[model samples]
Every structure is written in structure tokens, then in C-alpha cells.
Target chain A: MELTRRDAAAALAALGAGGAVGYAAHEWGSGGDDSPDAPDDGLATDEEVRDALVAVAEVVYPSAVSGIAAFVESFLAGRLEREDHGRGVRETVGELDELASEWYDGPVAELDPEDRDRLLREVGADVADENPEGTTAERVRYYVVNELLLALYASPRGGELVGIENPQGHPGGTDTYQRGTP
Target chain B: MSGPATNRARNRAVDRTPVDGADVCVIGAGPAGGLVAARLADAGYDVVVLDAGPRFDPGDRQERMERAIRPAYDRPDVWGVGGERDAHAATGEWFYPLNHARVKGVGGSTLHWQGMVMRLHEADFNSRSERGVGVDWPIDYADLRPYYAEAERELGVAGADDNPFGPPREEPYPMPAFPPSYSDSLFAAACEELGISMHSVGNARNSETYDGRSECVGYGTCQPVCPSGAKYDATVHVERAEQAGATVIDRAPVQYLEHSADAVRAAEYATPDGETHRQEAEAFVVACGGVETPRLLLLSESEEYPGGLANASGLVGKFFMDHLFAGTGGVLDEPTRQNHVGFITSESHQFYDEADAEVGPFKLEFFNYAGPSPVELALTGDDWGDALLERLNAEYGDHVAVGALVEQLPREDSYVALDPERTDHLDSPVPDVHWNVGDRALETIERANQVQEQILDELGAEVTWQAGPDSTGPAYHHMGTTRMGNDPEESVVDPQCRTHDLDNCWIAGSSVFPTGGAMNPTLTIAALALRVAEDIERSL
Candidate 1:
């Protein structure tokens, strides 16, 4: 239960073993970016991304199951080739990993549950100050975490999945009634 | 019976005969040709107006169908160019190409425009006055204001009295302001917190049924074509002229404006079926938008007026203007999303009037709303890898977007000329546009960004990454090509919208606007058309 920098680092280092636990490390560490059509070399893979998403979602919303991870993985996979778009997420994930090593001395997925929650709480303010200069990743990471929670807990589908009352009101479909380029 | 009845009968007999004839004939339509044709027809002359654009009818199916099927490039929808390279024009709507300029069939480009009318601020009229930047407008805003009011009632705009920015006017708007949408309230609340004032944009759309048109339905699709008759386009004016016994021909494109010694004698148009028609008139008017109007004049060079008719100043195809737009979006702590449908609900004009306090200000207006769908939002991303998409969907709702329209100073450098190489499907030379932002233009944008950031913070919204520091795109408010001016040396058209070199020819649309103020350009375009309409009436 005592999560520390050494524990997270050891867990991340053992990811290449190709087992259930190793799958998380493989997914988070080497996002499957190897493709002839791949626009970039550092993109994440479905399996590896799924593993990491599941790990993050558990800490973000502990009660959810395999759903959020699948959603995030599929969504990310679909945007691999869109220029001016994919860079934000890539930068954010890369920055997240870097911050994990700085704060916890290890991979983010290896942190204990209590420490993981603490990291999430502090990230809101900390990520805002990261600046990222020429990249959009840090901003993407900050945005994505807040959005995932809002969607998972506040959306209609999310409402049916879990019991968090979406206080934002009018789940979906209504706001989209006549929206077009104005 | 002996005096009045006999005179009427004689007038009718004369009308029965072809009153006037010209070499090149323009058909009846909207603002594009209507304004020009009317002026020519009134000049003790013979100009034929063959307009076939959809006539405004309250809930008329034939009108709707006509607007829907009119091809902009005059091609079938299935033949449209597709893919990411042309995604901005993904679906060519019924009447015209999405943004190709013109409503196709008739009244030209003004058929479905929301008449949010305001002249370019004085600085806009004279970019060179204070900034010493950009070319001076052939005409100033003060000169255009009288005409702006004349055009206001002609098009019937809805606005409040005494505008917060710029010069004072004699008459108030015909109708009150259009109601603010739910999004407007939210944005207003945020603006208030940031000490910025938001105003209801003056729209040419009828707030409550005026000038024989029905009230507005706030239909989201105001561009391309409006299903509601609330919008005052050129078609209405064309219809009025036709009702007064003007003959309108449809499906004909004027190819040339034949001029002789500073007088346009005729306009030549090619019919859709490939027939050349010649009608002779005493005078001619060129109401085509900035690009096409000048193009026709240039294309019609004869032995008489070389280097294009009415090109004595050599300024016909110069000074093209389109307001630059950049979008900013972020998430708010409170849920203020409502009435997501409607055109612009509110505008931040607080910065508009005070734009050029020191070196002379330029116009900048702030507009925003919720966000587009996931498919559309994908276009806003900077990264293209797999991880990017996932993050996008995950972060969709945590944001609201603000679009800032920055007015550019009129410069000869930013012009729309015939491209040396690029041609349209019709083998005609496509317009090659070169628009660049100067140091002052960039300064206006930076100031807009600062205002946006302050407003976002006041709205209790969390900031996201800003999209525009260097990137700028056309907001589709094209203006200033055949500009009106005091001196004929620098302008193609005179203050009354008459060609400086051509005594009988007149021009309309944003082409006459010297500077592009931050407000939408359509209203001013409509106003100018109306002012020219009054001038045409007087000369007769």
C-alpha cells in the first residue's frame, strides 16, 4: 500500500514482460506508433493505450470498468493521421509520463491509489503552468482529464453506467438541435 | 380623361415597344446587376434587366427550389470537388457555391445576407489618415453615412439608436435589435465580469415583419440561403423594380461593360444555353461584387477604353479586403449553455469605437458560442496521431469558443487580381488573392486575444491553448476593390458609386468600402446599394 518512486519505477520497467500487468507498461511506455501510414513515430497502440487508459480511469473514477479505456483508445487510434491535431495529445501523454517520474520517481500507472488521486488533484493547477511553448500536449493533458471525468460522470451514457447525477443538465441531443457554422 | 388618361395610354404604348437597347444586356436579379441596371435604365437610356434569381415569397416552394438547385459554378452538386483539401467547401448548398460569391440565379450575393449594417469606421474609410498604413479609401465613412441611412430603410435593418461606436447618425434603425440567444446571455455575463460591454448586433433581418417581408425565425443557416423571408437580400429590390415594369432575364452572365468616352453604353451577357444577346442602353451600371464587377470592366477592353474600361486610375482590381478571424475556446465552471441555435446573438463592440485612440485604431469584434460536433471539432486540433483523437473527444465539452474578427487596413498589397495560372472549371481566370496582415493588423489581433483571455477568466471558464498567433483566415466579409473616393486619381468609382472615368456606370457591394471595420460587411454593402438606388432615382 505504501506507494513510492521506486515502486512505480520498478512496475513501469517490468512492462515489457507481455503479461496482464506487463500489458499496462507496454501500452503506456511504447504506444503502438509503428505503421506505414502513421503520420508520426511516437503514437500509442490500442492494446498498450487500453491498458494505460484502464489504469488511469481506475484512479480517476475508480468505480468504472473497461468502458472508459476502450472509448479513449478507439478515439485516439482514429486521429493518428490528422496534422495540427494529434500533436496535443501526444505532447500531453509524453509530458504526463515526464511529470510522473519527477513527482513519484516512476510511471504514473505504478503509483498507489491514494498517491494517484493526490497527483490528479495537484495536476489541475500544475499543468496549467507548464506552458509547453511550441507544443500543445500539456494543455491537451489538462483538458483531457477534466473532460473524461465530466463526460463519464455527466453524460447520459455515463449516467446509465454510473450513478453520478449530471448536474450540468440536459444530457445530449437538445444542444445540438440546429447547431451549424454561424 | 382627355389629359391624364391620354398621357397614360401614350406612356403604355411606348413601354410596349423596346424602350432602350444596348450591346451587352444584363438580366434582372438582385443587388449585383439590379443596382447597375436600374441606373443605366434611368439615364434616358436602354438597359434590359433580365433577372431570374429566386424572388422572395413568404413560404414559396418554387423560390426555395430555385435557390436550392442554383449551381454557383453552374455545375451539378454531384460534380463538386471533395476531400480534406476542399473540406471548407464540403457541401455546395443549393443556390451558389458555399462561399464562391454571388447568390447565382439573380440578385447576386446579397440574396440571403443578414443586413448588420455599419460603415467602416473613419479609420476604415481612410486607413492612411491616422496610421499612415494601407491606402486611403477613395471615399470616407462620413461620406458613406448619409448613404448608409438611405440604404438602412431600403433594406430595413433592426438596430438601436445612437451606436456606441464611431460617428452619430440622423435616423435610427428601422427596427429594434434582434433578440440575443441563450449563448449570448452566457457570453454577456462573462463580458460584464471582464468589464467589456456586449451589444446586440444590428441586423438587416426584420425583427417583426417590415417592407412586405415576414418576421425572422432565427434559422441557423443565414448564409447560403435563408428559408425565412426575414433576411433582406437584393432579390427583394430586384422584385420591386420588376413590379414597376422592369423586364428581368435569368441565367445570363454579363461578360463585358462596353463603354465610350467615360460612358458605359451596354453590358453583354452570355446566356446559360450559350447564346450571345445584345441589348443597347444609353447608360450602364456595374453592380457586380468587387471582383466580378472589375473583372467584367477589364475583360471588355475595346479600341476606345484600353487597359479595361473605367481603369483610368488603374485601381479597379486593387485593395481587396476580408476581415481576419481567429477562434478561442475553453471550459466554464458553470453550465450556461442554452439556445444554441441562431446566428450571432451578441457582439462585443466595446473595443470597436475606441480601436485607434493613439496611432488611430482598427476594428475588432468578439463573437462565440458552445462548440461544433466531434467530427467538426477534429479540424481544430494541432496533432494528427492516434492519441490526439482520443484526447479530443475526451476534452470536447470542457470548452466554449470565441471568434474574433479583425479589420484590416485597406492596402494595395492585399488585392484580388486575376491569377496568372489558376483557372476555374469554365476556363476563366480565377481570382488570385494576396492578403497579408501588417504590424498594425497583428497588433489589433493581439489586443483581441488579450480581451478574449480576460473575458474567459471572468466567465469562470478554464483557459485552453490559443489557436491563432500567426494564423488568420477569411471571415468571408470581402470588401473594397472598386472603391468610391473624392479624387478620381486614386479611385475607380466616385462618392455616389459612379465610375470615375465612366459617367454612366455605378458600382455597389463591399467593393466601395475603403476600410473593413470589424462589423459584418453585408449591411454596409446593402446600404451602399440603397444609396446608389436613391442616386439613380434622382438622375432620372
Candidate 2:
């Protein structure tokens, strides 16, 4: 069996742990005004983008990491400006906000880490198989969380944690090639 | 031996009409066309090669690495519809979503090809006679053995070629393969622990610096782009063809062929600016992949042959094939320490020959994709914040992945024809693929699953991901659309890849493959191209 997030969480839940352990694996995909998502009307304001990054970053990344919010916001905003997928990403985060409001009666940024984790897990798993037809959280995993995590680890700061030390394109010293493969 | 020219020069591409005279016109500046154009031009025959997409170079090693390591453009501007002008794969029912994977450029899909180059097993050639499945190729493995040897030298292949699993070769590979990483070594031991035979296969990538290219630098990204130029892309050969007096025109989408009296007279290409350009040549070879080849043939419908050009057998776009692929991944308790390194190391044909008469043979390729990237892991699973980061920090590279390519027998129904409604920007009809795997392929996939399980289980892996039957991702080898056979009545092209309808029009690349074995088709495609070029030269 593949150790999915739900699997690990369920394992933790079985251990009677607290603080995001017992997430409600509710039957999801409800709520919202029932109109189709807008075709990416550019990114939201800087504050909105920053809030979205901080909310997800607080849930997905390690705590006490300085400048985490700044790193994520710049990465997210920069991608939105460039790639076409960035527009979809911006829309997905807005969807996450919608789902967060429905589930917790508040925004993702305001919700405690536990509630945020719960909503993300429930929404994320619901849309795991196939998507564009799910609650905001479910699709947010695809659009926002997916890109967020990608931006985090594929960067130099993220690479340092995993022993990559100097990410290839981080504008470093003379040698750039990683002599790892044949 | 018979591929790249030693001349280093720029490939001056024509932007629009009034094309330069050429002895031959080859459509698609890909592996086959690039090599053929180079070979002809080397022999002093003026050649013109046309590609639909713009020519995008990966630049020098460091720059290429920079692009690969960056985001959005992380995969080079070679994939998808709008980003880099690659085709939107016309998918059919039950076929995998293939549009975002294949690239379009002067180097063609070779720019994005994973450099796994292995010859078809001898048994693969006689499947019709021996296995009682699929049509027998008009030519055998022995017929193309010399050309395969030549392609290896030209492409700078490195491997231990004296394997019992492989077909007979005239000589050893040009260089020994790169050493396997520690994780790969563990995977090999696990395979051995389960009594499975494992060996390294020939890779087109350089093990040590040879020719003008550098060695592999382990960027872990070979599919989208190869940084060090160690893995051979067709642009260098296309440039060589240019140096030898051949011309490659960018954005010249070949819409149709202009033929008369059972011979192709001139080729018509739609320029980017909505203008048509006529290029006449002594001979015409369409190497624009399997789908594009048939699409072009069908789009070039004439009054004499209303159905399609050179489609006299009505098999021009039939029997389209892709190898049955099943991927498996698992995580280990201990870090492999050799994660993120990206050389394709060991391959096992231990389970290649199936005893079950219901299924075709399959080859399981082992890869050291031991790192599922901390970000991917964090994004997935039920971990959040410190939990996610802590988990990621501990187990980044402690992962392993292995996959198998089951031999898919040619089925008549799985085909590629011109979509009746759809057309490209050039107003040429796009390919409509009707492809799917059957019960035989499923059985092969199940067997592959068992092999994957046997290895992972022995290693005491905690978790695994094997989308066995759900694996529909294409292996990217487009073949058998313009299949080769002895009878003109049954096949689109003859054994020498000459269309029965047109004497001067020949087909090149994997498009002419009668059967696609469980190995990557680039080298085989290269071999066929070299052989066809030689034949074309002799004829000229």
C-alpha cells in the first residue's frame, strides 16, 4: 500500500494524537455559488497573494523559518506573471479561500494550523483521482498546494534542507553541473 | 560511424518561400530526417529538411543546465501547444493524455528523449512467425545489424553490449556505460535477492567525454532537456547536414505532397505567415513522426487517390503502436544518499520472455529515481508544516522507482488517421488517434506488477505506488502508422520503406516500423534512417 498523506494521518489518528491528527474525512465537494471558475482574471492583489502563500506555507512548511512568507509570495507572484499555469494557480488559491470560508467560517490565513491541515487533507484527497470537479480544497491541492510545494523545494533554500546545498540555477560559483548521474 | 558530420557550423534555416534547390526534401528535422539529410549532404547531394516548429537551442552546457533547473521553462520550451509550438497530441478513447509530453523543435522529439537506446531483441523481429502474434517484419534483425552498429558509433552510445538478452552486434559499444549509483546498486542486489537477472543497457548518453560532447552531469532531468549535450539530440546532426550544404527551414509545416504519375513531384509547406511554399526535389521522405506522417499523407489527398497519398493498401495510418508501460515506486527506511542523480543505469530483461502464451514479453527497467523531491512528498500525504518538513528532511532520497515496457502487438483498430474536423494553424488536418491497450497488454502489465512487487517486497519497502492497469502514459515512441511489410497490398510501405504508390517517395523513422519492441525506438529509428539514406544515395 502506498503511504499517502491520509494513510499517515490515519496512522497518527490511530495513535490518539492531537493538533491536526483527527481530521474529518467528510464527504466533500459542496458549497460555493455554483458558477464555473473564472478563466484566470490575472492574480489577486499583493496582500491576497501573500495571505494565500502564508496560509499554505504555515501548514506545509516547517515553523520558525524566517522569510518563508516573502520567499513563497515572490515565487508565486513571479510564476503568475510568467506561466499560463500561473493563472490557474491564482484561481485555485482563491478557490482554497472559498473552501476555507465554508469549512471553518473564516479565511485560510485566520484558521489555526490544525483546521487548515484538516481542510487541505479533506479537499486534497477528494480530488486526488481526477479534478476540475470538486470542492475548493480538493482542486486547491492540484492548483495551489501542488505549485506551492514545487516552488518551495525546487528552490535553493528548500534544496539546502534536503542536502542539495546549492540548487543548480541559484547563481553560484564557477561549477554549476551536478556530477551525480552518468 | 554513419551519423553526425565532423563539420561544426550553423544550420541556416529559410524563414519563407523561394526554397533552395535540393536533391531530396525530408519532412521533420528529427532524428531520422536529420541523419538522412546529413548523410545525403555529406555525399554532396543538396538536401532540404523542413520542421513545423521554431528552432530552439539548449545553448552551452551551463546555460542548458540553468534553463533545466529553472521553473515554468524548467522543461525547455518543448512541451504543450502554445508555450513552445509543440503539437497537442490528438488523443483517442482509452489513450493517455500525450499532448503535454512530446516536444517540437528542429531537433524534434530527440531534444526531449530519455537517452535509453537498446536494440530490439532478435525474437521481436519474428513475432508473427514464432509467437503467432503481429505481422512479421519483411526484414529481420540481421538485416539491420550493421546499421545499428553504425548508429551506435554515430550517436556515441555507451554500454556493456555483450549481454545475453540483446541481439548480435558486430562490435562492442563505443564506450562503457556510466557506473551505477549506490541506490541502483541496492536495487540490483534486491533484484538478485529475488533471483532476477539484472544488467546495464546501452544509453545514447556519454559515460565519458567522447566526440565533441561532455559526459553526463546527473541533472536528473533528461526527458525535457539534456544539459551537457552528452545525450545526443538531432540538432547537431541537422546542423551537420546544414554544414554539408543541406537547408533546414523552420516553421515550414509540410501540409501535403504534390505528386504525378506515381511519383512525388513537389512538396507544399505552409509558412508561419499564412503563405504556401513549393519545394521540389528528386525524392521525398516523410519522417515527421508516425502520426504526422500519416496525417500529412492523408491530408495530401489527390483525385487519383482520394483516400490518401501512397495509401494504396489503405494501411497508411493503421496499426499505430506504443509499448505497454507500467511504473512502480517505493520508499526505503534509509536514505539512498544518491538521490536526484539522473543517469539511466541498470535494466533487467529477466522477465522479458514470458512463458504465458497470452502475453508478449516485457522488459523491466530499473531507475535510480530515489528522490521523490521533498516538495512532492510535502504536497502529498497528510503532513503539514513542521510535520511535513520533518518528514521531508528525514526521507528525501530514500525512494526507489522501477518500470516495465511490455511488448504491444500491432492491432489494426489502434490507428492514426487525419481528424475529419480538426486542422492545425496551417489548415492541415490534425491526426486523430484511435489507440488502446487490450487484455494481452494487461496480462503483460500484471506480470510486470508481480516483478515490481517481488523486488520491492524483498527490500522491505513500506509503501508503493503501482498504477498497473491505470498506467496509460505514452512511452513516446510513435510507430507503425506507415508500417513496412513485403506486400504492397497489405502495408503502406515496402521493406525498404518505399511507398508502393510513389517510386520517389520513401518513409523514414519509427513511422515505418512494422512492430515496436519493448525498447526505446530512437537507435532503431537511427539505424533505419542510415539504411534508407544509403539506399537513397545509391538510387540517386
Best candidate according to TM-score:
2
What TM-score does structure 1 among the candidates reach? 0.62
Which consecutive 10 residues in model 1 chain B have the weakest lDDT in total?
Answer: B87-96
Tens digit per residue, CA lDDT, model 2, B250-353: 87888779998599988898775568889999989898897778988988889988889998889888888888778777888776644454545788886665
> Candidate 2, TM-score vs. the true structure?
0.76
Model 1, range B257-368, lDDT digits (tens) per residue? 6567867765665553455555566545566565566666767778876777788888876777666665566776544332232355466556765556232243333333
DockQ of each: 0.02, 0.11
Which 10-residue window in model 2 chain B sums to the lowest lDDT? B1-10
lDDT of candidates 1 onward, in order: 0.52, 0.69
Clashing pairs in 2: A5-B381, A5-B382, A59-B385, A123-A138, A181-B218, B1-B154
Q: What is the total number of backbone clashes in candidate 1?
A: 55
